[model samples]
Target: MRATTTPALFTRPRNVAASVAAAALALTLVPGSASAQQADTEPVDVRLKVADAAPVEVATTPQAWPGELLEAYGVSVDGNDLVDVVRDGDEVSGERKRLRQGDVVRLTDVVKERKTKRERVRRGTVEVFTTELKPGVRKVVREGRPGTRVVVARKTFHNGEPVKYRVIKRKLVKDPRPRRVLVGREAYAVAGANGLNWGALANCESGGNPDAVNPAGYYGLYQFDLGTWRSVGGSGLPTSASAGEQTYRAKLLYKQRGRSPWPTCGRLL
Candidate 1:
């Protein structure tokens, strides 16, 4: 036989099992492999609540940010709106946090508005006593006038509902005018006339004017004529005498004639 050397081409590996194991480990350590990528971006389930609306479930990656998730979910947020995140029953900063499984995202809409309104100020009453008319008589000297004011306020709304209101400014537009009333305190000693409604009689005769004078010779608060005034012991003209004296004389006349001196106004007494 000729001395021929066989080639090592058909030689078998000494550690074939170890070589297969090393190859499998190298495949698992690859950075761009499907298993590695899937592990890095695992899907997470989260809940999103926006401005009084019902909560909705969303599926996102664990590394996703709050704003990015909202944008992907078609949720728009304004500049004044607020966003909060809750995880494991505790609240966290939405801006600095990433989405996690079982996480809750809350969105609140905030709005501020300025309003103005006109308000009315009620007027007061002032009473003045005078002896120019009989007791218990009243006269309106000046009518009351209400004032006006403008109020400015700031209203805050959360989730389209009013939350707080604060007054910013107040301006007085007009001052209120008080009502002036004149009351009577005159006294009389007539038996049946002192207790009569002399005020109504005066108002019916002379419109409650103490210096009233009629063209038919009637004068004073009671509109007494010259003859009737003298019969009641009145010396000067009824219009020239004081209001107290005129009332006294009218009472005396009423006691004598029993309201027959003035036919038209006697019904009032």
Candidate 2:
């Protein structure tokens, strides 16, 4: 029998595939490897500001949406709230942009409030023409009173600061009272009567008595009848008018009828 001793056969382990995979993973984790470089690019640090609150530092991955980042930080947003990106102390763009290192995300709270207030309405002046005084003379008969109005407005605010205001409705609470004034319409100077002796005529007509009255329905210093008084632009009873007013109407009458209206008191001037 051949004492043939077979040489010892060396066989590879069945775990060769596992060992190769482990070696490949180790190479990828080494410095400057593709996996190591990819890890370094993640976990970006950014600043987040919400309304008037203080800014906070947050960590996120590159190219991550700002909405997702906010969700991760447990922040909420409303439909009216404003979101924006800031860089170098200036706004960059909308909030839908991806996250970047050293970027700031700002959230502004928008609010609208309805307000009601009362305001004053200024009064106006009204003029009433009369012949009680000389022309160009004015007298206040009634004082004016201001009115009130209710105003309803919508005020908009951003982060507790007022931004816009608009008036939505207005209602008059009280009507304004107009000021009433009496203005004179008699001419300052009556033609052809300036050189005449008005005092003599008045004394001869009613003895210079402004309140004089006659049984023939004549009254005042000029003894004017109601028909003649109104023809000379006189208002109310001539006896109720002032002495100067009575004289003015008499002068106007003289300019028209040449003292013919005062038949008994004629030729006194």
Q: Say which candidate scores most in TM-score.
A: 2
Question: How many angstroms is residue 231 displaced in model 2 relative to the true structure, after the best TM-score fit?
Answer: 22
Q: Write the per-residue lDDT of candidate 1 for residues 1-269, one digit (tens) a residue.
A: 01012211111223223322343344234444332455556667778666666566656657567765554433455677777888898888734478789998777767889999999988889988677878789999999899999999999887788999999999999999999999887554555667788889989988989999899888989988899899988888888888878888988887787878888889987
Cα error, residue 5 of model 2, in Å, equals 82
Q: What TM-score do all the candidates reach, one by one?
A: 0.46, 0.49
Error of 1 at 21 (Å): 45
Tens-digit per-residue lDDT, 1-269, candidate 2? 00111211101223223332343335334444333455666567778666666566655667666665544433455677787877777777654377688889777778889999999998899988677877879999899899999999999888789999999999999999999999887544565787788898889988889999999898989888899899989999999988877878888888888978877767878
Q: Please provide the root mean square deviation of candidate 1 (C-alpha atoms, Å).
A: 24.0
Query: What count of clashes does model 2 give?
Result: 0
TM-score of predicted model 2? 0.49
Clashing pairs in 2: none
Model 1 CA deviation exceeding 4 Å by range: 1-39, 63-65, 88-90, 93-98, 128-138, 183-269
